[model samples]
Target: MQWTQCITSSQKRLTSASLGAITTLRLETSLIHGKTILLADLGLSSFQLTEDSSSTAFIGVDDFYVAPEFQTFRDGHVQARRASDIWSFGCIIAEVLTYMVKGSGGVKKFCDKRQFEWVPGTWWNRFHRGPTTPSPEVTTWLSELQANGEPYRVRMVGVIQKMLSLDPKERPRSAQVKKSLRGISILSLAKLVGHDLETAYKDDQCIDLLLGNKRFRSWLSAFKRTFLSTKGG
Candidate 1:
């Protein structure tokens, strides 16, 4: 069983580059970046999927991938493999597109404690940044948007190939994910916030700041007094 939708708390704050990419895409067309939701939450079980089933039906959840579930050693954990991240992103796109084609069906939706989607960049930009397109033969989502006026289906095909490629080196860079799908109406998760669900999550305060209100602040003081007193710092 593949589990996608694992996002890091750090991702809630996007880098300047990530924000820049997203802003540019939005300027070009009223692009919408939706929240990052995992298909696993939908409870869709995986089957011994064949090559054919892979394309039309939902991809095996075991293979479902998203970029953010990747971990950094800073949080006291093993660093996430870049290849693993790319693979996960591929699953996210497939799951979303599949759901659009076939109703919820066997697929499920999930929310990780720390996952966040950038309102700015495609999965490719979320992973790597490049001045030019990375793939010559494999078109990126940005490219598709530039070439044709529509590319919903084309984008999914590329995500599937890169995510499932046996050779990690053969997979496309994350920079190309949004670029290749250029014109397609691959909706962003941002627009869905108030419409689909309501939360103080998208509020003005930083998640950490929100978590550290007056009550939490007192707790932090106690924690520091107990922990810091024990250490020199």
Candidate 2:
């Protein structure tokens, strides 16, 4: 499908002398402004947007991450990885974390001040990529979240791990996943972006049920049956 990107800012790009290619530089910045406005909306900041700096822009990736992790389902994907999905979810977490660290360092009051803008939203019909899974780096982070008491944090970590499962077989269905996320606590991220971890979990349940045809379910049933036999039904 054709790319649908938002416009953040524009700048004249002269080819870089070293790489002889155009790069992300000195275009009217969008990341920081967009982030700031979002943070303000999320109740995480007091930053305001201006006419020149407040606008947003979008662009399509010329290439997807090329990897063996792609799984074709629903619509289709190119060079997709479980980690790609994981990364998408991780970005959501990163936003939450950015809020936690909003006032620190060289960053603006809101991250929106960065020079670029991305939809930061999932692609339409984006589903589990099957050929490969997330790296250990990802699972380690997810484990950290699971070990924590914060519900939203755990859900965030778990959701990413589920999306990035190395063995597609161990991954949860989108619906069962939704159930697992049920009741997870979520707080505001940045200033304007609102997230609901609990609601996400509930919605995940619907997806799980619909994708019940995966062999993983039948295998689980058989494995469990071996451990607990009953009278003939």
Candidate 3:
């Protein structure tokens, strides 16, 4: 399904960053089919389209998913790049993964874990603590996700870690992230359907059957295990 429009008339009064956060929550609840979904420009709304139409330039802020560089820009202009979009997509996917493994409460706890006092009374909860460093809490939470050892969770966490890299240049492009996620989904479906990974990946029919089954799709979304229990982080 298409992402819900978060920038409604009532929401127009909200800050752009707040709109982004609302969009993120909507994404968490949306039905995301692994193979068919590819978010190339998920959180980028303030970019200006160039005359070429194929090219665009970042001019303003889209706060909640703003890259670290944008946060530190002093000159009022931030040259947001494609890598910035990758970072935003990474954050979105990370939350989606959290919701998949743990429930919405777990996602809330995850956010709480990232919060810290920026100054006397100001607190920040972005994935990055500074322009060049990731939040320690985010790193720790990722480590916990890695410890789960479930193949899909492990692989996704790895992709997310790269996506949330402090340096935008280090983040993978949208195509790469899409490929990795698709592979992970295939492998997980293989495991779920009692098929070998190779067979699932190579057999188009097998993939189609699995994707076409409503029950399978439902199971995929609702599937949960003892990952990061609700007791605590």
Candidate 4:
């Protein structure tokens, strides 16, 4: 999630990063950063191209981050799809935004009040289906934000609502999310960071941000060397 803050950084953002490395914090930080989803994780290792095909497909995940379709899979109703990852992306985004707007306990409250357990039927059935009303925390924050009529809040809410659609297909693709963010003016973008846009974008720390992660830097160096040798040959 440390990378998430970089993604929202004005001049930097995720222009050259991969989503697979994104944690809950990073996903939220992207919201603060402007839209421009980069798929830098295109490298083979990041895509798990070397993964053993004989390994069983992950059908059931016991984590709270598991998507609704995975829950349905556990119920014997359907199989999980690649799109399921996008759904999990939306949920993580929502939770992060909720935490930001409503304070630390916001997501916790939502999870607690709804009894969001890791069990199969407990999650999707409780949150995705049935007659459960919209969460008051989220609803209240959004409503209050919109009531202010700030373009920043309006645009932010627009992207969030789409990402969190109940139907996975209805949710925006990552590229589309980028497009939406790109459309917003820099002034609106400033509101997300709570200060002058110049200050955030000017931080020199961004240049060496990735180098702080020794493992990623080593892997990147090796990949670069390999690619260069192959090209020369």
All candidates' lDDT scores?
Answer: 0.34, 0.31, 0.58, 0.44
TM-score, candidate 4, is: 0.47
Could you give candidate 1's per-residue lDDT for residues 166-226 as a string of tens digits?
4456656544444333312213222243233324434555665455454444654564465
- Over the stretch 1-233, how does candidate 4's per-residue lDDT look in tens digits? 23322333321232223323222222322333344443322122322211323112343444444444444454455443334444555555556556656777876775665454335674431234321233444455555545667665566566666655556667665555544445444334434533333344356536444344444446545644553354111
Give the backbone clash total of model 4: 3
Q: TM-score of every model? A: 0.31, 0.29, 0.63, 0.47
TM-score comparison, 3 vs 4, better candidate: 3
If both were scored by TM-score, which would come out higher, candidate 2 or candidate 4?
4
TM-score of 3: 0.63
The worst-scoring run of ten residues by lDDT in candidate 1 lies at 19-28
Model 4 misplacement above 4 A: 1-56, 74-79, 116-127, 130-147, 182-185, 190-233
What tens digits encode model 2's per-residue C-alpha lDDT throughout 79-131? Answer: 32222322333333433433443434412322322222223553321212234
Off by over 4 Å in 1: 1-79, 106-151, 186-233
Tens-place lDDT per residue, model 3, 70-168, is: 677677754655566567667777777787778899789988888888789988777787787778888888888778688778878888888799887
Strongest candidate by TM-score? 3
What is every candidate's alpha-carbon RMSD to the true fold? Answer: 19.5, 19.2, 11.5, 14.3
* Candidates 1 and 3, the one with greater TM-score: 3
Candidate closer to the true structure by lDDT (higher is better), 1 or 4: 4
